[model samples]
Structure formats: C-alpha cells, structure tokens
Target chain A: MMNKPFENAIDAHGPTVLRVCRAVLGMTPDADDAWSETFLAALRAWPDLPDDTNVEAWLVRVAQRKTVDVIRARSRQPVPVDELPTSIAGTDGIPHEADPDLWSAVASLPERQRLAVAYHYVGGLPHKETAALIGGTTEAVRRAAADGITRLRTTYGASAAQEGTR
Target chain B: MMDTNNTPEFDLASALTVGADEMDSLRSELARRAADDNLLDVTYRTIDTPLGQLLLAATERGLVRVAYEREEFDRVLDTIAQRVSARILRTPARLDDVARELDEYFTGRRTTFDLALDHSLSSGFRAEVQRSLPSIAYGHTASYGEIAALVGRPRAVRAVGTACATNPLPIVVPCHRVVRSDGSYGGYVGGVDAKTKLLTMEGAA
Candidate 1:
C-alpha cells in the first residue's frame, strides 16, 4: 500500500485544518496549538482509515471535533463575532500581513457560518463535501456559505463600492 | 466597476505573502541580535565555524532562542524581546565563549558541551527530550525511538521526532544528534542538509 490514506488526508485537507484554526481561534496562539493537535491526532489514527472514504470530510470532521473538545475543556468565554481580534501586530515590527478587512469580516461571522465558509471556500471543497463534514445537506451548506458571503459583502460593500467609484 | 486604489488595503493573499516575508525578517533579526556584543536583558552571541553563523540567545533564567544561518534574525530577536519582556542587544563576548567551545568540539578537542543551558521555555516531555539528547554523546547518533526510550516511553518515538522538529535550541539541544534507526536522516526543521552536515561534522557517518 502507498499509504494513500495518510498522504491524501494531509494533502487534501491540510489547508482546511489551517482554515478551521484560523476561523475558530482568529489568529491567536491557541489556533496554532489546535492545528498541531489536530494533525497529531490525524497522524495517530491515519493507518486505520478506510481507503474508499472521503479524506477531506474526515479531516474536517476530526478538526471540528478537536476544536469543540478544546473549547469545552478550556471553558473559553464565547467571543462575540464582532469582538474577535483580527490583525496581529507583525512580530518583526512590520505592518500586519493579513488583509485586515477580510479577516475582520471572517472573524465576525457566527461560528457555524464561519466553519462553513472556511470549508467551502478556503478548503476548496464543493458544497457536498462541506455538508458531509458538518452533518448537513448540500443545500444547508450552500445557504451557510451564501449567508456568510452576504454578511461580508454587506459589511465591506460600501468600501468596495467606493473603490469601484474611484 | 471597482477602483483599484480604494480596494481593501489588506486581504488573505497579501497576508500570506507578507506573513512569510515577515517570518524571514524575524529570523534575520534574531541572528543579528545574537551577534551583537552589548550587554542587555537578553544574552546575545554568535558562533562562526565550519557550518555557518550560529546565534545563541539566553535569558537569566535559561537559554531561550537559537538561530542558524538565519536570514531574518531580527524578527527572532523581536519575538524573544517580546516574550522575555526584556530589551534585546548585542553581547558578542558572552556568545564568543560559546563559539570558542563549539570550535574546540568541531576540531575534536572537546566532546561535550560544558555550558549551562537555560530551558525554561520548554517543559515536561519536550524538556525531557532536549535533556536526553546531550546524553547521546559526540560521534554517536541515536534514533528517535531510542531517545524516547531514554525518556521512559518506549512507544513515543514519533512524539520524540516531533520534539526534535520543534526544538527551539537546535545545536545546543543537539537534535541533529538524532537519526532514524534505518540510517536515514529524519526531518530537521533547519533543513535536512544542515542535519546531514552536523552529523558528518560530528563524525557520526
């Protein structure tokens, strides 16, 4: 066997792992910790994965499960969508590297919507894949993505339009 | 129609590129601080030897940072400064002593590091792995499994590998002193060639 299960899991869903961490933890150090923990868990369990399974969905499911576990264990106060920190001051005295507006918009999303957006857009998964991961039908995943994007557009639409005018 | 100038100043694409560049700068900054000779809150020093420039940073509590051939030493310096809540400056004298000791080892004049290591940043198994690495001795390499065994967990070889991957203090902690039992040089965050060179220099080949 080519270890396709392990390789596919990492290759196909690695970015999703980063996206979930980014969404839930909002660029905090805890996000990195969560990401590492998720991968470590995956590495430990990868050998048992069925060859015909959906690796991306499986990884997302694992990541989601881990994130929830971490949240429950830590008893973190739920950060209101508007209150999450979006821009980290660059560690080297440079300007912030991430697009602050996009990040802020992403950070302001409800937790489920945020996860759906990350899975669909950032993870490059189709609506079906996203639905499978989050335990919803394809239509529900589509609605979540649409709702999330609409909120981002509403929040940033004026700026986007003003730029268009100029 | 969209105006290019009024477009959001930052976005995901820009952030990823900028983050990568920033990380590079940070690595260089750390290296520069390590080479400076002024006494400051953090101990800074550089070692020049056959491998390349090596930066050693320490706090009163313990060794906190090390960088090798780093292009972004400043960022590393800034991170250390922020973490230790101390001003960072150059203190080559402190580092020169370390360099001299390393030089002796490279020339086969010394077999062990006599320097006191400050590892307050690491704890539990991570610290245990680092502590166990030096016991591998010079000119001998141990597998990750073997090191984990020494740490009292016979099955934690992979975790031991992770510990090596995350070793912030590489040379001093001697993560390069570890290898795979299959005789393959496993992953080194500093790059595999660097790992190979360190092993070859140590005569482990």
Candidate 2:
C-alpha cells in the first residue's frame, strides 16, 4: 500500500482533526484526548484506507465518533462559554494582533453550528463531509456554515469594519 | 449607484480571515504548556526535506502534544504571555541543543537520536511496542508480525499494528522501521508518504 500517502494525509489533515476535536470537545481537556484517540484510530485503520479516499473526511468521521464516545461516557455539563480556556479563547489567550470579535463570534455559535463552521472553514471539509460528521444532509451542513458565517458577520462587522476604515 | 454609507463594510469571508492572529495566540498558549516539568515535553527540530521546513514540538510523556510548527521562527513575548500559562517563557537557548542534534541527523551526521526520551504516558503493551522499535536498526525493516513476536505476543500482530499506529514519536522512535510481512510498507502516524520517505531515506526499502 501507499504508506507515504498515509503519512502525507496525517500531516496535511492534522490541523483539521484538531479543529474538529476543538469544536466537539470545546476547550475541555477531553478535546485533546479525543484528538489523540482519533489519530490513533486512524493509524489502526490506515492500512485499509482507500487510496483515493477523502482523508480529511475520514479523520472527521473518526474524531466525531470518538468525541461522541467521550460525551457519552462523561456526565459533565455541555461546555460553557465562560469555561473556554483563554489560550483557546479568541484573543485573550495569545498576544498576536487578531480580531477578537470574529473569533468570539465563532466561539459563540451554537454547538451544531460551531461544529459545522469548524468543519467547513477550519477543517476545509466540503458540505458533504461536514454533513457526514455532524449527522445531517449536505444541504443542512451548508445552511449551518452559512448561518454561522452570517452570525459572525453580524457580531463583528460593525466594529471590525469601523476599525479597518480608520 | 448605491450609497456607500448604506453598504455593509465587511462580509463573512473577510471577517473569517481576520482570525489568523487569534490562531497564533492559541498556538503560543499551547506552546507554553511545554515548559511544565510535569508535562514531559521533548523538543525535536528536524529539517523536513520534502516539506522544506523545520519541525518542532513539545510532547507529554506518552506523546501528548502541546505545540508544533513547521518553521523555526520565534514568537513575540506578549503573544507568549497571552497563549501560555505564566510559568512558561521563551527558552529557545535551551531548545538549541535539540536543534543542534537534529541538524546533525538531517545532514547525515547522526543516525541514532542521542537525546533523552520521556515515555511517561505509555504503559502496558503500548510501551512494549515503543521499547521494541529501537532494536530494528537503521536501514532495516520488520513486519508487524515480527514486532508482535519481538514483544512476546506473536498472536497479537494486529494489536502490534495498533501500537505502531499510536506511536507518539515517529522518526525518533522509528516506527518507520516496521513493515508488512508481505514486503508492504504499513501505516505510519505521520502519514503514509512520510513513512515511505523515511524508509527510502534510510534505504530500508
């Protein structure tokens, strides 16, 4: 088999996997756990991965399944906005000059919408793959991504645009 | 023509692009975790010949990763503060040792990784696989079944494959040394191509 292609898939798709884990597990430590588990799962299954398969989508599917398992095993509350670690938070965790409003808006999206947005924008999955991960149709994923983007626009457009204009 | 005042100044695509700074902050915060003594961080700097970038990261005892980058650039101090816990700080001078050794290896000057490894996170059979991998030697390959046999679990060849899949460290630990019994290159945590390249580079193929 093409072992090299498998390695390339891991490198190229690593961030997307992380983003998917982040979306599902929020900023909780479990997110990291899930991320590890997802890759581990991918490693075990890589020998069987179809040569022309969408590796990113495959990773997302594995990550989502692992995340669901974690969620099922735990009895914790759904991740709270306030509990998001500053490091993972939009601008509060780092010193780079980024638009806080935009990230906050992303962080503020509802869980489903947030996952959809992460898969679409951050993970770079198309609507079909996004749907598969989130358990919806392609059209539904498109709508969620669109809606999430719309929300980001509403929340950050006014202030960020004003700042840009000056 | 529409009045400029009535038009929305930014769209969704433009807004999303503005979050790169936020991602940078997140990366720095993640990097800070590497400094904790309890974190079991190992920094490796290697010239990735194919990607044409240097790779570095801090990992926990069993390879719980904190931060990684493809470049050798340093982060600004303020960014570090926001991303990592206050306990973490710029210690590039300390990391330089790793850089030096990695540089040697990339230039064909070093073969074995002489640095200390923190394998704290691994236990049971998984740890066994890690322990067994180093014995495969440079420029040699073994099958998953062979590794299983080496670990005293010949019946667990598939399980051995699982362990390799979960190998936290790739190049240093040399999971690339493992292959299929049928002369096939098996799975690699870094991806298949990376595995092939490592094998090809080492003349294992």
Each candidate's DockQ: 0.05, 0.05
DockQ of candidate 2 relative to the true structure = 0.05
Off by over 4 Å in 2: A5-7, A74-99, A136-138, A162-166, B1-205
Interface Cα RMSD in Å, per prediction: 15.2, 12.8
* TM-scores of all candidate predictions against the true structure: 0.43, 0.44
Q: Model 1 off-target regions past 4 Å?
A: A1-166, B1-39
Q: In order, what lDDT does every prediction score?
A: 0.65, 0.60
Write one digit per residue (lDDT tens) for candidate 2, span A1-166. Answer: 3233233454466556666666556655677677766765565566455557777777877887888887776756665344433234333454434355565566668777887877776666777877876788888787777777667656776665678852
RMSD of 2: 14.8
